[model samples]
Target: MKLREEDLMDILVGATILGCGGGGSLEEGWKLIKRELKKGRKFRLVDVDDVPNDKIVASPYYVGSLGGNSKDNLAVKSFILLEEFIGEKFFGVVSTEMGGHNTAAALTTAAELGLPLIDADMAGRAVPELHHSVYYIRGYNMCPFSVVTAYEDKIIFSRTRDDLHAEKLVRSIVKVTGANVGVTSHPIRGKIFKRTIIRNAISLAMDIGKSVRKAKEEDKNWVLSLLELGGFLLFKGECVYMERREGSGFTIGEFELQVIEFYLKMRT
Candidate 1:
């Protein structure tokens, strides 16, 4: 699917809804879209099967607190480092999660490197921790991945093949690097990638966005659209209270949604 400039807002809105509480920085997502648009560059969504099996493909995303100036050029720098480490150019990018900023990383990094953005991802929805990814659960090659932060911190994991341990090491580094880093993990062949990745994820997000827009235009209940699209509505209410805390390189919080006569308690 072609990632048109006009489709960006719908995609952002859809991705945010799919984020399930943890896709970062909507403003950053917009900035990325504008930057690539100004360069007369095109952002495309490539089918995963179209990627050459011999080439390398990796997931790139921001990992840290959703605050401050954590969103910037970190992912591009991290990709540069990944290519340097592997001694081969990445063939394409697969987003780590579906969040406003994270999902748009697929577009931004592809434009930055003149590469393809695969229409797939490690997770179909946003997750707070790296270990929650489908890539981690499938037991792919876990070593020699790159982590680069704006603070000039560069760390690579090579010794351990353990995914959980790798996540722990990265969490510690994120803390040391002031709580956020850009990561590109385990570029693998297309055959292996197919086994772990959720397919056609970007297009699915765009569909979600389009549905919401149509619902608004028709003056229909937008939340029902999500249900039609196979999403379960967990709550329907107004936010009564919210609080967040950053610690141990993780953001933890809770919120209350008042559903008329009752309240839905949630945590993340």
Candidate 2:
């Protein structure tokens, strides 16, 4: 898969739109994606059929406190470090946990690597922990997982017999990275991918993004336009409560109205 230099911004915009309010801020995801684009990496989106059945596929993304660090900073380049540790050309596949940011994180990596991203993810919705992926439920091992963080000063490498252990080790590394570290996990074979992945998610995200962009430009009502585009409203409410914490690690939290109405778990 070869990426063109021009499409990265549109892709990032679309990914953030899919985030449904909870994904990482668009400023952060776009800043990292754009920097990679400037570095001359053009990514391609890959279909599940394109990967070999026996080869390993991994998902890399950001994990951190989404509160205090909400502002955009173009200096963040954690994905490169994670990719460096893997020490191979990667095909950015979305993590099983779905959010605006993770979905975009997959494409941004794909664009930067000039590789075709897999259309599927392990989980179809946002999840709080690493072990929550559908891949683990199917008994897949998490070998070849790498955790990279700026403060860690070194890439953490692991070949785990179980995904849970991989999660445990990576979470420890997240602390070193200051609550928001980039992680890549879930190596899978191409053959198993046919059965396990939510196919064409990248393209779907792009299409959704295009529609939203059109709607915004045409001055159409956002909610109505989204509905017209076949996206269901998952939630709609004013923020009534919010909080923050610094426990074992940095923590940020918020609550808003019309709960779960906008949470559309895209089908593979």
Candidate 3:
């Protein structure tokens, strides 16, 4: 499927909902799409099967806070650098996680560079840490990693003994860069990617987005649309209070939604 300009809206919304509140921001996602579309760039969407086993794939994503200055095309730069370092061409770009910004990382870079965007992603949903990656769970090594910042600074790790060490390395790099950086790694075979990736997850996200829009058009509860997809609606209410703590290159936070009566209480 070719990603058209308008598809950005539904895709972003769907990815955000899939994020479950931990995914990258919707605004940042739209910004990347709009910027690329305005530049007349085009991107092709392909399933895992579309890419051959011998083909190389790179998953690109931001490794820092979404609110930071991440508008730079560092991920794309990293991809280019990786190709030069490996002395080979990358066949496609992939999303590390399904989120507004994370999804855009692959799409925007693929579109701009004329590479295919893999239909599946490393993580089916947005997660707070790199250790949450499906690739790590599936026994893929997080190595030959590349990191880039807006300053055009670049670092590549030939290999990491483990994913935990890889995540720690990324956090340390982000701190040293003093800005959010783009990361892409594991230039593995498409066949390996097919085995590890959450297949057709992007298509599911697109469908969910469309359903949510249709539900709104019908004046129905949109959350029910997600419930149909094995998702539970935990609660529905306005946020009353929100707090967050920033440390160790991460922000942790919690919030309370004001919903009275008929509410089930659980201790955290």
TM-score of each: 0.90, 0.75, 0.91
The superposed Cα distance between candidate 1 and the true structure at residue 150, in angstroms, equals 1.4
Question: What is candidate 3's CA lDDT for residue 246?
Answer: 56
Q: What would the per-residue lDDT of candidate 2 be over residues 1-268, giving only the tens digit for each residue? A: 4545445555555556655554566666666666666777666766788787766567777666554241232112444544466565444465444565666576666665555677666765556667776777777765555554555444545566576766666666666556566666665667776787777655655666667677788998755666765666555666667665644333555665545346565523
List runs of model 1 lying over 4 Å from the truth.
68-71, 232-235, 261-268
**Ten residues in sequence with the least summed lDDT for candidate 2:** 67-76
Q: If candidate 3 were superposed on the true structure by all CA atoms, what would the RMSD be?
A: 3.1
In terms of TM-score, which candidate is strongest? Answer: 3
Q: Which digits, one per residue and each the tens of the lDDT, describe model 1 over residues 9-68? A: 787778888887778877878887788788888787789889887888987777777763
Off by over 4 Å in 3: 258-268
Positional deviation of residue 47's Cα in model 2 after best superposition, in angstroms: 1.1
Model 3: what TM-score? Answer: 0.91
Each model's lDDT? 0.79, 0.59, 0.81
Q: Candidate 1: give the clashing pairs.
A: 144-157
Cα shift from native, residue 99, model 2 (Å)? 3.6
Candidate 3 lDDT by residue in tens digits, 146-194: 8888788888888777888888988987777667788888788878887
